[model samples]
Target: MPEFPHDDTTTNPFAAEPQDRLDANPRRAIVTGADSGIGRATAVALAAAGVDVALTWHSDETGAQETADEVRTHGARAVVARLDVTDIPACGDVVDGLIDELGGLDVFVNNAGAGLQTPFLDVALDEWNRVLDTDLTGPFVCLQRAARAMVAAGRGGRLIAVTSVHEHQPMVGASAYDAAKHGLGGLMKNLALELGHHGISAVSVAPGEIATPMTGQTDTDPRTEDRPGIPLGRPGDAREVAALIAFLASPEAAYISGASVVIDGGMLQMGPQAGAAVDTHDWRTL
Candidate 1:
């Protein structure tokens, strides 16, 4: 395989200006797609930060169990559930059942997603509907159910959507996926507005290429991969993304909401000029 180049730069993840704000107060959280990658990492992070987690998987109940085990290592009770977010009617039952089991819901991480990479012309109605329903509609329902529970709990909560960089930009062969992400981003913004008064914060975390099972990369060190397209010199790590979610879920982020944060290593900034910037053959052409 051809090697990808990574930007040879390093930066600190924390600031020295203000005292660090780390909270591990043992809250309850539900992380969808917790079977692997970003979902699994987020679950681990939440658990480590003193949050009991309900791990929901699309088709990886085994992986979800593994995550639950890791979560339990952090002394947080972890539960595993088979959750196909695309099954719209089943969403309510799943959410309600899980919340009931957990006693109460405090943070909901909508991390489940399905990607459809067909071009616009080749995308059939079923493909469009499948992607939209799974990526957009399913989360919409889950958000509502979680929000309702949060409102009733009267504790104010964190609602996070694990969107994509495509949520803010576009790709050649990802029309359907892009559409779904765009819709998800918009829905989060609206949810942020609607849920604010209830003390719930809705935010979208847009990740660029990350070393995750979703990207056909698991257990691979992203540091070894060369990704010139990313200013950071490599694709992101799932743990890195999870750290963001953990911070968002913490009490320190209580004042933040309705924000769409891009964690793409500056790829979004080079969108229009990437072709010219790469100095390679016309590989960008479809």
Candidate 2:
């Protein structure tokens, strides 16, 4: 038998102290795409949790200001900024600026994403790249910046990505969207693994058919709507999704990293059953 080398310096991984420990209560957060929809809801939710928020928007400055107002109602500091994630590396700079304005960052929520409904065969190179840049590349840059800030501060943090149900299941006419979400979900898992040593948690919140502007259901009451395919009989509300995000951002979720939490109304569970029960081929088109 070969003699094993003595390794007196080896220590139990579980016994090692994290490079940075999470704050007992997170104090500041950033929510991108807070102009409206899920991002807006998440911003307000964090504020209600007594966390100061920095809100970023792409097109709707008015909407972002509205979200900031709501955040202020919770007695939390709210700062607004314009951020177009598709702008590439510049977006990462915007994140850094916001982190600075907030004094520090305890959480960063990547909620800005776009999808194209064009068929895969008809998708132009520009369109595909646009979607990918917005949904994946840009987010990766910003999240990386946020992670660096957290590491430098030596105070653990949370990184939340608002992915889609498409992250787990592909959709018709959503090739680029599906690919980006899948990549984002994978990225979050990797971040969780790499950042855990620093006490930072990374998670993905996947929503399905939410009543948001992205779904053309802004201001719509999901409870009043009916969805025959979903077991819950309706689409989800942004607030519901936000609530889940808020929980994940909390210290209570320190051990729940490297996970994609789905907030669909039992939609994923109906996959095979719905496929078998469909009475028409209309689903083939967007």
Candidate 3:
């Protein structure tokens, strides 16, 4: 696991922008993988901005409930659901059910993802399938269902996916993950073109080295985390990433679609060569 703070929810002092920053809308959303990390923070931020949020968790019901509880503190209705994004047949049902529960859906954040850290030559077929299924195929199904819902409702909507820096750059020992991310980026582009006529906008937010449970860090203060490789010299707070998502979900971003906005503390600016030349850390085992 990556090193993260235990009380991470409080780490980022810049978590919530003024509620007025959000353009008014249905104020309803569904966030997948809301049990932790970027998903949880996005949910909380949306709720704070008066968006009723329905959150889904794969295994961590406790974490899901905790997130929901925080959402409610903002006076927004929060629902908890069980979801496995890779479960294709269930995607439509789950998405529709959440929309029904929320009265309607205005935003869908595809944040649930799986990754592989094996060398390209060593990656087994099963591992490859799992990464593609969860990272690429899952978002495809979810986006389709969500876009259809938004279209049928005749109300404009927001579709945001939490991609990674890998979406734009390759990483050592992450062949499967990189391929899946690239596919996801392409999918979002297609969705924007396909859904724009229906008043729906599709976009992807790419982040690098976020402090989350998946990285073996939970609730840790990123400000104190010494990360020499990152231009900011520290890991990004999950809430910081969430703040960006909240902004994109706002009606202010209506004109923005098919964009892959990166929030990596300028990490991508450092190419693979710079990584080898500057950071002594080996990324292969990551």
TM-score of each: 0.89, 0.94, 0.88
lDDT of 1 by residue, 1-286 (tens): 9986643324433211132222223389999999999999999999999999998988888899999999999999998888887798788689888999999988999999999767677889998898888899999999899999988976678899999999998887788889999999999999988877666789999999999988998899999999877778899999999999999999778767999988987889887767666676555445
TM-score of 1: 0.89
Compose the digit string of candidate 2's lDDT tens values, residues 215-234. Answer: 99979999999899999999
TM-score for candidate 3: 0.88
Write down the lDDT that model 3 would get: 0.87
Q: Pick the candidate with the highest TM-score.
A: 2
Residue 80 C-alpha lDDT in model 1? 85
The C-alpha RMSD of each candidate to the native structure, in angstroms, is 10.5, 4.4, 11.2
Off by over 4 Å in 3: 1-24, 272-286
Native-referenced Cα lDDT, model 1: 0.86
Error of 2 at 122 (Å): 0.3
Instruction: Tell me the tens digit of each residue's lDDT in model 3 across 13-81.
Output: 533233321234648999999999999999999998889999999999999999999999999999999
Q: Which residues of candidate 1, in runs, are more than 4 Å off? A: 1-26, 278-286
Worst 10 residues of 3 by lDDT: 14-23
